[model samples]
Target: MPGERLTQQERQRIATGLAGGLSYAEIARRLDRPTSTISREIGRNGGPRGYRPQQAHQATVQRARRETPASARAAGAPLGAAGEEIVELAVRTGLPRMTARVHVDLLLSEDGRRTAAELTRRLRVSPASVSVAVNYLVQYGYARRERDPRRRRDVYVVDDDALYHSVMLSTRHTLESARAAMAAAEASGADSPVGRRLAKSGAFLERVSLEMMESADRWRALLA
Candidate 1:
C-alpha cells in the first residue's frame, strides 16, 4: 500500500472531496488509504486550492516517464568519495537520503548557487523529485531561493550564513519555549521538582542563546 499509486478516479474523488470542504483524513478514510498518502498526493500535485484531477494524473505520468532508474543513473555519474561520504554522514545525522543528497550537492557546489533545473540534471533525478528536495532544504534553512538576474528561474543558494541563521532561529524558539515552560511550572508550584527543572532548563537555554549569538558574531567577523 505504501508504494501504490493513486488512480485517476481516486484523484477525482480527492478533488471532489476538497471542493466539498472535506478534511484530508476524511478523504483518506473514504478512499481506504493512509492520510499521509492523500496529503502527499494533493501536496505534490498542487495544494488543495490548485489541485486538478486530470492535470495531476497527466503530471504524474510525465514524472514517471522522466524519472530514470536510480542504479543506472548512479553508474553513469557516480559521485566522488568525498561527496558520497558527505551524503552518508548527512543520512546518519537524520536527513532523508534524497534530502541529504540534495543538501550535500548544494554545499559542494563551488558557486553555492544552482538552478532547480541544474540540480535535477546533476542529481539525475526528476524535476518533481528535485522540487521536493529543494523545498525541504528551503524550509529547514539549509538553502534559500534567490532570483537569477540572467533568467526568470530562481536559484537555490547554500552559503555559510545559512547555518548561522538557522541556529539563531532555533535558539530564539528554544528560549521562548523555555521561558513559557518556566512560567507554567511556577504557576503549578515554584517549590516543586517540576518548577526547579523548568527553571534550570530556562537558565540553560538563556545561556545557550547568548553563546549562540556570540558564536555567530565571531563567525561573521571571520567571514568579513
Candidate 2:
C-alpha cells in the first residue's frame, strides 16, 4: 500500500539502480512503487551519487525512533521495519532467524553490546532463547562475550571485526575441507582417475585459500 513504508531491501534496490544510472521511473517500476516515492526517498537521503543503502536504512530507523514517545520507550520501542529487514538480510546470509535477530540487535544497539536479559526484554523472547542464540554467535566468533562486572552480567558484544572474524572463520573451514578432500583422494587409490581429479581440485582450493588469507592479512588495515 502507498501508506506503507519502504523496506531496507527496496532502499537497496534504489541505491543499486541509481548507481547504475537508472531513471526514477525505471527504479519505481522495478519496485512496483510510485515514482514520487522513489524521487522523495532519494531526495531526502542523498541525491544520486551521494546515496547509500545502509545509511539510508539506518536513517529511517533513527527517524522512527525519534518519532516514538518517551513514555512509550519505558517498555522499549519496536525494532522497526528497517531493523527487521536487517535481521532478515542476516538470516539470508545463513544465520538462523533468531540468531540473526540477536546479532542484528547487537549491531544496531547504541553500545554494540547487550546482556541476555536486555535481549529478552527487547526481543520479547525467553532468556533461554537469547542464551542459545548468543552462544552460537560467540562460538563462531561473530560476537565476543565480556563480563560486565559493574552490571553483574555478561554482555554479548558485536563490533566492526565481527564480519572480519566471520570471514576468517569461513576461510579456515574452507582450508580444512580442501585438506580433507586430498586425504579422501589418497584413501580412494591415488592412481585412479577420480583420485587425480579430487587431488587437483583440492590443490586448487588449498592454493586459493592460502593466497586469500595472505591478501586478507596484507589489506586487513583497510578494515580499521
Top candidate (lDDT): 2
Which residue pairs overlap in candidate 1's backbone? Answer: none
Model 1 ranges with Cα > 4 A deviation = 1-78
Task: Report the lDDT tens digits of candidate 2 across residue range 137-199.
Answer: 886678999998898889899987777787677677567656655765676668887567667
The local distance difference test score of model 2 is 0.74
Residues 1-224, candidate 1, lDDT per residue (tens digit)? 23345655467667656755569998898777999999998999889999998888777755753674777436324456788788756544435457767787888789888899988888887897778778867865778999977898989998878887666655665555456555645765778776676667667766887888788777875544
Question: Candidate 1: deviation at residue 153, Å?
Answer: 0.6
Q: How accurate is candidate 1 locally (lDDT)?
A: 0.72
What's the residue-level lDDT of 158 in candidate 2?
Answer: 91
In candidate 2, position 202 carries an lDDT of 70
